[model samples]
Target: MAAATFIEYSKGTQFVSTHIYGSWWFCMLWGALAIGTITYIIKMRMHSATLLLLHTSFIVILTGALITHLFAIKGLVHIRKGITTNQYIVNNGKEIKTLPFNIRLNNFNIIYNNGTSAPKDYISYITITDDKQSKDGYISINNIFTYNFVRLYQTSYDDDGNGTYLTINSDPYGIAISYTGYALLFFSLIWLLIDPNGSYRKLLKSPLLKKGMLCIMFLCGFSSVTQAASTLPDISANKFGKLDIMYNNRICPIQTFAIDFTEKLYGSSSYNDYSAEQVLTGFIFWNDEWKNEPIIKIKDNTLRKYFGLPKYISINQLFDKNLGGYILGPAVQEYYQGNHDKLHKAIIEIDDKVQLIMSLRHGEPFKIFPYGKGDNIIWYSPKAQVPKSMDTDKAMFVKNIFTLLNQSAHSGNYNQFNSLIAKIRIYQEQNGGNTLPSVTQVIAELTYNRIPFANILFMINITMGFITLLYSIYRLTSIKNNRHITKIISYTSIIIMLLSFIALTYCEILRWIISKNIPMANGYETMLLLAWFVMLFSLIFYHRFKILITFGFLMSGFFLLVSHIGQMDPQITPIMPVLSSPLLSIHVSIIMMSFALLSLTFICGLTALILYVTHRIKHDEKTIIDNQLSSLYLLSKILLYPAMSALGIGIFVGAIWANISWGQYWSWDPKEVWALITFMFYAIVLHKKSLPVFNSPLYYHIYTTVAFAMILMTYFGVNYFLGGMHSYA
Candidate 1:
């Protein structure tokens, strides 16, 4: 039973994929999809043994994930502090399904948060069990217990109050996730110098080798493409049990019930007492039938038959649990009233702190009157109760859904709420109704419990890609490119640009199959999406200025790589805190555009350095043949200048975005540092006097390598090691 987590697709189309079987076995789908993906890669007519081998690791990763989960347990073990006797807690660690047995915790410890809200530490001593046989052990974060196939992460606490709170967990899929991670990391390593954009020596003297390399490049791309496959479902979103969410709609017994200020305090703030009116935050459990409505009689009262409300009391008789009596606190005098119509228009004050406002009347939802002004309320409730339906309201349909919800709660099938509205419209139509299931309920389901932290797959793969990119640049400088080298650089950049653009677009669109109005939340996602925009612009601008095209491609690759790596964030996590801002999406999109544009400048700078070192240039030959060719010096002179200009403009626009989002012109964050560094490198490359220690071909390649390294340091290194604003996971 999933607690409360995203049950279906987020609004974005990038992270979640659609499957016909209605199972969230995306990990499983990835395995099967990997097979088809393998076949597709082979069929691409792109055959290079090197490329094939380079990407084979990806297939291995898929194999690894399949093996780890289906055959082994790869989950985390939590450790906390608490116990009468020093021991361990061993659990079968299965979720939804009942775990096989319990592993006791012999001992546990806490690593306190040293600084304000900083990191803490955990250590747990645990013991494993199989029937009567048992063994003792202790585990911590990044520590494992292999015999029972368990990995332990110092996760949470279990306080026994008497200074004892220790707990631990054993995760089955933990190893599988790790294997997938390493597989991705390995793929990036192989891809760095071997893929289309890598720094491999272009042995194009042999046309056969060139063609073979082409095939290899395709294989690499093919491998990357497979990662887009789906995996396993933990009974999350698709199916509905007794009262799956499809049948419940948004109606639940867990209403945030509120009763207005019962009494106001009479004295000063220091010695003030307040009275509160309480209502059921919980749904009517078991036998309780809240038949306050004349038209409805929904009850399963056998649960708490004797539980009944006390006599309905006036404001003076309201209970004051905090103050031990009905006396009001000094600061609460403002709530003294007879009919408290304004109370229904008030925010809840808990322990004298402001909380949610009364957004409805008794048995009815409130009209959203803004802090002081608003005529835009969609609907307002007259009383705190369900509104009477219209003649075509399909009351029976509503009743059925609520019944399902009640039943699901009774049966303890929490995930069934994942599809409580399983047959909303069909029943509605059958019973005479006009409204159908909203798109949110048509196919997708969401519950916060399904995932913990952010979508981590992006965090690892994208980050690893950047590390590989840096290594690739290192490889690039050491290799000598003959005449064919230029051709490969020119051709590969263009082809990769095309591929990147398509892949980026597809990634962006895949976000929302069920449509929960969420964007790609991870930093990796933002980077990729932003890079696509950047490349799209580069492709457009590069076509206008030939030099800029090569420059822009390099820039796009750098930013995209960094973005991929920056997706890793361990400290930060995914929080759906109901971000209610109308301007957020627009502001974010604009910032993304700025990132892409700035990226274009970075590309130009790298191209300028590489061109300067090579000391020779070749046109597409097909385009400028039969004409007096411009000298290499003249071309380099012209290209570097424009490239520099583009870089500057991109940075300036990026500054504008920084100001709007963060309310600052710039922050010395890692990604920002790299952006600026890239800008400076290009600017210097344009000026003769500022050239680095090397001016020859070798030096040029070396500079290019260093420049891109700086890019990596800014992207992945900064994100991973140094940390920065862009270090979002």
Candidate 2:
């Protein structure tokens, strides 16, 4: 009944369900819905468009996720040097499949500008085919290839032609859900906006609206499905393979690998097909030339000929593991051609592309097999693209050429640093195989879209410190305040508001610059960049409503107070490759702008609290208090609406940017979680008019204080504790 049944993982961790669900998507969707609901219930008021966007996006995103989690196909293909002139190995996690069609690697090339010498970041290229059209794949960073619904990326490189390339794959199901979510969310926005002058009330109360809401609720239910879809699964197979070389007795997973060989035009692709290459016999040559490449007596003469000639498949030439198979692409062609052995070339795929080339050895022939290989499966040395000339016999170092294959690794692959073992194998009579390098070489290069967040503690702290200095000076100068002095003080407050705005702008610009070299590498930097943007824009409106300054002072002061109280993190410097991108500027900048924007509402609520705190002290107090409340009301009017409006705008913009870059409008990253929280914070403040108890200043201020806490969490707290992609800084 099941397409593929997986026995209960880890023996028995009980709970019964036949359909497999992915957590990455299912968990996130449900998480989004639950979080969204909680925010809606608490805030009480919301932008009809945002609610729609959030809901619709969730549905499509989850649907795509279901398709991905439920049924996604994955496999790998391999290419080898003269050995596998035929088919490439196709690797899948559970089973390795040998394809019928023979793929010949034509050539591989790395083209780069002559002017720049910066390790040619994007100059790699490769070509491979199914015996038909000349297909190609190229690699850069972040961008991979699109073949049908599957996108391919070059994951790694190796010298041995053994499988070592790594690739990132996306199941179309996730994208489908993502697209559906976007369609629904986007359409809902249009539906939300068509309301007439009285549309607000009508939209909120309509029966259709209620149904739409119900649909959203049902759509939200899909989160359970989505979470199961999005979760990353850890899989261990019976055989593992590298560079088309399989590890015996382990589950063979189809995988892709890359080769950034010692030379250019050498980047390529290779996969494992679980072939049985067993080493049948080994021979030791006593001649002094043995040092360079010991003589090997293969069991069968016919089998030995298929290996080409002593000149073509020489021992010394073929055995250098360090200078091994990392060579892929056109380099294989160039090497084979130069040596004058134009047989089948090695083919490999890098980036989303592939390359093919023929190769031959220039050194002496070392070992032979009886038409069969021993060590049925073993990691192979990336064969060296043998040169045109072989080292003379005088160069022999008395090294062991033939080795009996074994499980795990060759005699010296793992922790090769053991000198005692090296000494033991060094005995002249014993097979003293060369010391192979560590498996670390087998480790793939760590290149991701971005590391996703970190660093910048220094920047936030420095900015806070700078702003606090200005406030400290203003407070120090206030000795006696008559009405005239109050006017001057008001003007000073205006300056601070404007400066806060300026500071935010400056931070954004600096981040823009910083992100060019950092942050763009991952999702976290993008989020921080957005936060900064939100903070910057919020200031423009505050300048229009000067009353907001009273609250602004408290808000800014609170930030300063918290910084002083909390212990600072050490080394707020940039780290990780993904942290380097301009996207961080956009992501962090906007989010911070929202913080500055929504903060004013929190301040107004604070004023309301104070008003309630001393209500009985009214009458004359009303004059002074009126001064406060009047300022507060003017500020609230100017502040609350715009703050809410700006925050809403910032969030909307954020979602748009996220969709453009990541393809999904909203991910339940910590930043997203906070954005929802921040939106709801103001939503409650705006709708509180419906609640009598909250009408009192004290209650308002108390709620505002709580809201402020949420703001703090939305900005700083999430990063500090609740880790997510945007948690970087």
Candidate 3:
């Protein structure tokens, strides 16, 4: 199944996915598994009816999915306001699929984020009518409408607000059957967990387990950690560092603003220990590449054929009193001298990465025509190479401000420079007409030192997790009374995990307060929340199952480390329109939490398998290995129940959200299909104990370790490799 999913992902086609599942041999294989399962149940009369239904639910789900593949109708309907459309595009725009009913778009509207044009939601108001009935409704991402067995989902809208595009799917027959299977699967697993015959009920009854659960519950409450308001400083410093300017729709201290600006331009926040503010300051006033080397030395001559005629030009030449008389002409050199207004007028935008550098260079032979008849030619005039979409006023403001900055850097005129920054702040507020605060532009330097605790917390998590794993192994193998020290270290690790959890929760909340919305709207925030869930659940399960502490620490530490990578750097940004649903927060939390639980289970399964293999080879410590294996098997079992259940619920909730937002509950997008596959794979693993042929503990461990690949595909593969409706995730 993992191989098939990867193949489908590589192909980037839904038809390829259907081909894998809809193949005759695939059906036959599933049919055989179903028949064999039924036969075993009938012959053995399994002790648990819930187990029988759980196993049978797979067959039912496959039946529904196959029905969808063969009979479902999926297409796209694009409509403008007051326009009625019965035909929709299908087969990748090759043909038209006509619905039995016609849909009329009454109105299309979008809700924008506060003080910004970024859309928070896209709503399509529509009415559907057939020969027998008529229905009027509205649809948004996560909100859908059904009429005459067909579903409509609002997928996108024209930026001009003149048209709305919706995806329509008619798979009434298969969806009902599939949903029935979904319910049965959900209930059957819940029954297995709580049933008198189940192992979970036995584990829950233990006094030690119950007490441990209480402590875990207490620790989980740290999710609500809060912080006090911060006070801003008003003092003499870098003037540009004090002025606030908005970037990426986030309001922050100028120090933070500089970091984000540099990140966008240089693809990193800092270089050679110089913070973004330092880089920006140097770029504007002294020199951009502030090193011993001559800035902007035209050493790469290419035979010196591009420019009409020029000796080596260095930025140092600008300060040479004779530059205006020595260079190409006075008109160009005068701008580089003291004519701040003239220099500002010559600035123009070229690209986002070189916004500051390109604007500073302006007209002095900086434009390189890299292709065509004038390839590699350097244009001396700003008008010869300026982009049509350049915001001239913004460029001018930046240039004039930087010119004052250069003078201040040269003569130490701090008061004048500071006043100019304050004056510019007022000008930007009154005349800039930007949604974000003008203060965001202040050239304050910032580094990772601000949140040293966050760094320390992550280190504690990883280091403690590693130490606990080592201690856990020592406990497994040692014969001495190390319980006291082990307990101490264990408690200390738990304390650190608690602190880390609180710290992360605080950061997430602070972002929510600043952004005025839930923080799970992006990848970084979602991953952070996942780390919290892993720690919380691991701590919760720790008391009842002490082995989980090691696994939890290792997994949480690893995931948190991944979250800290530069790519996942948690920068506060605007949420996309489709992610504006109220259900988005709940939906993402459930799914991420489910993945965390399953990750711990995967670790337990791997440990069990290793112990079993080691026991077979050594033959010396069979008893100890068996004891460890028993505990691990039980832990994995206990963890899998909730993991599978949560995944199932999350998938269904996502479908409901999809229907509300897109108008269809199921679209068989790569991500959606993989999620279903993951749920079913775990369901089959749950029934492993019921079937004698697969009752061995080895099978249990192997199945779990392998089935985890499905979750990996659903979470990572779908996002990076497969094309899907859930691509926004």
Best by lDDT: 3
- The candidate that achieves the highest TM-score relative to the unseen native structure: 3
Compared with the true structure, what per-residue lDDT tens digits does model 3 show for residues 679-700?
8788776555555543565677
Q: Candidate 2, residues 493-544: lDDT per residue as tens digits?
A: 4554456545544443443342224333333333434434333333444334
Q: Please give the range of 10 consecutive residues that has the lowest summed lDDT in model 2.
A: 274-283
TM-score of each: 0.31, 0.44, 0.73
Error of 1 at 542 (Å): 8.6
Provide the lDDT at 118 for model 3. Answer: 56
Q: TM-score of predicted model 2?
A: 0.44
Candidate 2 runs further than 4 Å off: 1-134, 154-177, 183-482, 496-539, 542-544, 553-584, 616-704
For candidate 3, the per-residue lDDT at 409 reads: 57
| Winner of 1 and 2 under TM-score | 2
Ten contiguous residues minimizing lDDT sum, candidate 3: 223-232
